[model samples]
Target: MNQFIWSFLCGLGEAKYLNRTFVMDLNMCLSGAHTEDGKDVNGKDFRFYFDFEHLKESVPLVEEGDFLKDWHRWDKKKGPGRMTVRKVPTYKVTPMQLKRDKSNIIWRQFDGKEPENYWYRVCEGRAAKVIQRPWYAIWKSKRLMNIVTEIAGRMDWDYDGLHVIRGWKAQNKKMYPNLDADTSPDAIVSKVTKLIKEWRNLYIATNEPFYYYFDKLRSHYHVHLLDDYKELWSNTSEWYNETTAITGGKPVPFDAYMKVIVDTEVFYRSKAKVETFNNLTRDCKDGINTCNL
Candidate 1:
C-alpha cells in the first residue's frame, strides 16, 4: 500500500464544500486500498477538526454549527492534536477541485492513469454519493452560541437581524453601482423602518462603522453590533485567546472573522433576516462574486 498525506487547504467559511470533498476523498482512498498514514481509517481518528495551530497563525476557525459537533477540538499539547509530519508525500486538495468537471479529475487520479510513483493525491471527490445531508449541512459552535445568547439576554427583548451589507459587493462600485445606493444607511433604515412593527431591537452586522447608522436608526429601533459582545466573548474565550497569543497576535484577523461568522449565524437565526439589496446579485460585471476567474 502506498503511504500518502491528504492536505485539505481551504478557509473555514468553505467547510461545507470542503467536507463534501473530504468524504469523496475518503471513499476514493478506501476504493484504491490507500490507507491514511495512521490508525484505522474508519475510526474517529480519521475525522477532521479545526487546526488550532493554523488558526492561531492566521487561519480562520471552522464555521460554528452542529455539523462540527463530532470534530475533535484541538488543544495545545492535548487532544488528538494536529497532523505533524517532518516530511511526507503530500497531495494538496483545494476548493476549486470540488466543482463538477474538476471533481471528475479527482476520481481519475485515484482510479485512472496517474503514474504509480505519485504518492500524494491533491484533488477531491470519488464518493458513491457525492452530496449528502450531513456533508453539506452547517453547525454553529456551542461556545460561540452561548456567547451570542448571553449578549442577547442583556437586551431583555427579542430582536430582528440587520446585516449592514458590505464586502466584495460593496467594494465594486463600477460593477455594483447601485449596491452603494441600495445598502446605504439611509436606504437601509428607510426600508427596515417600514417593515418592522412595534419598534424592537435590530442586531447589526456590517463592515463599516456602527455609529454611522446608530443614531439615525435608534429613533425607531434599538441597535446592536457584534462588537458589543466582544468583552463577553473575550473573557470566556480562553482557548481562542491562548491560541491567538501562541501565534504572536496573528490570530487577530480570525477574531474579526469569528465575529462575522457569529453575526451571520445570529442573523440566520433571527426572526427576520434583512439585507441591503433586495437581491444581492451574485452576477457582477467583473465576475467578482459570481464567476470563478
Candidate 2:
C-alpha cells in the first residue's frame, strides 16, 4: 500500500509536469501482507479505498479503461501507424528529456529488476527538484471516511485515541526490548489513567489481534476497537453495497489495509492522540538506540 501511494504520487507529478491529463488505473491488487488471509488479492477497485471523484477535482484525470477505448478508436480511424507513441523502458530516460516529445502516448514499461523497476524512481535525482508529488490530490475514499465519521459520531466526536504499536514489534525483544512490557494491559491502564480523565471514550488503534487484550482498560474508560464497528463494512452496510456495485456485484472484504486506513483517520479526529514509541515506551520507532537519529 505504501508503494502504491508513492507510485501514484509519482505518476501524478509526472502528469502535472507534462501538462497532460493523467490516465489512472482504477483496478488495483491488494498486497498479501495487508490481506487477512495472507494472500495477494487482485481486481480491487481504486474507488474501494480512495475518493476518485475528489481526485478528479484535484487533477485532470481519465480512467485507464476509458483512455484505452479512446486510443483504440483513434487507431481504427487513423490507423496505428499514424499515432505517435513513445515507449519508455528505463527511468534513465528522464522526464525532463521527454518534456518536448510529440508523442500521443508516453508508455513507461517497468520490466527491469526489483528497485530499478519501481515507479517512483522516475521522480528521483534531478527530476525530484522539478516534479513535486501532489499529496493533497489523493484523498481516502469517502465511503471509508463515512465509516470513520460514523465511529467518531458514535462517540459524539469526543474521544482520546491511543495508538499502541504492538504485534511483531513487541515480540522482537532485540529491537524493542521494552515494547512488550510497556504496552502490557496493566502498564497501559496505569499510564493512561494519569493522562486522560477516567470514564472517557477511549479509542485504541492497535494491531493487537486479541479482542480481549485491552479489556484491562475497560474499568476506567469506554474502550473502543476497530472490530467493534465491523457492521459498517459488513454485507448489509452501504460501503459493502457500493463497493460491490463497482466491482460488478463482487463483495469487497474489509481487509487489514482498510482497517489501518480507518484506524489512522479515526485517530486523527480524536481530541487527544497518544503514540506508543514516545508515550508508552522509550524504544525507538526503527529500533533501540536510534531515538536520537
Candidate 3:
C-alpha cells in the first residue's frame, strides 16, 4: 500500500510537470500481507479505499476506463494517424525531456524487472529535484474516515491511544527478544498506568489476534479495540451498503489492511498517543541494535 501510494504520487507529479490530465487506474491490487487469506487480491476499486471525489478536486485526472473508452471512440471516428501518442518504454527518458512534446498521449510502459519497473523511478536522480510528489492529493476513503469518526465518537472523542506492535515481531526472539514480554498485558498495565490516568478511555491499536490479550488493561482503563466497533463495517452498516453498490453488489470484506488503516487513524485522534517503540518497549522498530541509525 505504501509503495502504491508513493508510485501514484510520482505519477501525479509527472502529470503536473507536463500539464497533462493524469489517467488513474481505479482498479487496484491488494498485497498478500494486507489480505485476510494472506494472498494478493485484484479488482479492488480505488474509490473503495480512497477519496476519489477528493482526488478529482485536487488534480486534473480521469479514470483509466473512461479515458480508454474515449481513446477508442476517437480512433474509430478518425480512422488512423489522426491521434498523436509518444510511447515511453523506459524511465531513462525523463519527464523534463517530454515537457514540450505536444503529444496526444504520453504512455509510460513499466515492463522491466525489479528497480527498473518501479513508477517512482522516474522521480529519481536529477528529476527528483523538479518533480515534487503531491502527497496532499491522496486522501483516505471517506467511508473509512466515517468509521474512524464513529470509533472516536464512541469514546466521546476523549481518549488516550496505545499502539502495541506485537504479532510476529514479539515471536521473533532473535531481533525483538523482549517485544513479547514487553507488550504482555501485565507489562502494558504497569507502563500505561504512569502515562495515562486510571479509568481513562484507552484505545489500544494492536495486531494481537487474541481479544483477551489486553484484558489486564481493562482493570485500569476503558479498553477499546478495532473489533469493538465491527458493526460499523458489518453487513447491515452504511459502509457495507455503499461499497456493495460500487462492486456490483458484491460484499467487501473489512480485511486486515482496512483494520490497520482505521486503527492508525483512530490512534492519531487520541489526546495522548503511546507507541510501542517510543513508550511501551525499548525495542527498535526495524530490529535490535539498529536504533542509532
Candidate 4:
C-alpha cells in the first residue's frame, strides 16, 4: 500500500503531521503520506519516509520511525545519495487538489463543457510544480540502448535523446547529438510525421522520457502538461469534451510532447481499490495509466 506522512512539529527544528501517518512500499514512489496511526490527536504516531532517497537516489534506510529526533539514511541522487528535505525539489501541493483536478479534468473531456472554473477551483490554492525528472530520461535510454541509434536517425527534428542521455555535457558530442546534419531536415520532419502517425498511443501524458519510451513502445506522443494546462484552464470560460488545441481552439500542442502520456504509471497505493486497465488505455489518453495518473 502507499504510505504518506503528515506535518507535525516537535520541540525544535521538527515538523510532523499528527493527522495521519503511513508506511510505504516504494517500488518507485518518490514520497508517501497517510493519516496518523490513530484517528484522534496523537503525540507522534504518524509516520513518513523519503522514497526519493531509495528509488531515485538509491539510498536505503529504515522505513518506519518517529520523526522527532531520528532521520533515515535514504539515498539522494543529487547529493551523497542521502535522504534530506533539501534534496529533491519539492513543493507544498495539496493531495486533494491534485486528485480532484486530475480526476475532474478527464470528465470535462469525457462529457462536454464543464465549467472552466471547476478545473481551476480544484487546482487553485494548491502547490504544484513542473519538475523535470531527468533520471527517468536517462533510465529510459539505458533501457533502450539497443534501439537508441535507430530512433535518433528517424527524428523529424533529427534530435537524438541518446546524445544527452547523460545530460547536455555528454562526454562525446562528436559521437552523439540530438540533431544530425546528414539527415535532411525535410526528411526528419517527414519521419516525425510518419512516426507520429503510428505511435500516437505512447505520448499523451509523457514528457522528459519520450525518446526512450517512444523507442520501446513505438507509441505516439502527447503534449507536456505543464506548458499550458494552468493557463488554459485559468483563462477558459467553458470546458469541452476534449482538451486538445486541434479540437479546443488552443495553440497546437508541441510536437515532441503533444502525444505522450503523462505520469502513465502512478498509483494511489490502495489494495482494496480495484485497478482498472481501461483508465490509461492508449485510445483514452495514449495509454496513460490514469488510475495512477
TM-score, each model?
0.50, 0.95, 0.95, 0.20
Which of candidates 2 and 4 reaches a greater TM-score?
A: 2
Ranking by lDDT: 3, 2, 1, 4
C-alpha displacement of 30 in model 1, angstroms? 31
Q: What is each predicted model's overall lDDT from 0 to 1?
A: 0.47, 0.90, 0.91, 0.24
In the predicted model 1, the residue pairs found to clash are 64-139, 64-140, 64-141, 65-139, 65-140, 65-141, 66-139, 66-140, 67-139, 92-122
Relative to the unseen true structure, what is the C-alpha lDDT of residue 263 in candidate 3, on a scale of 0 to 100? 94
Candidate 1 lDDT (Cα, whole model)?
0.47
lDDT of 4: 0.24
Across 76-154, the per-residue lDDT of candidate 4 in tens digits comes to 2355544433211122233332332322111111122434222222222422132111222112212122122222222
Candidate 2 structure quality by residue, lDDT tens digits, 1-293: 88999988998899889888888888798888667778999878888789899899998899999989989877776655666889999988888998998898888889999888888999999999998898998899999999999999999999999999998799999999999999999999888898889999999998889999999899999999999999999999999998888878877778888899999999999987788986999899999889999
Q: The CA-based lDDT of model 3 is what?
A: 0.91
CA error at residue 229 for candidate 1, angstroms: 1.8
Model 3 per-residue lDDT at 16: 97
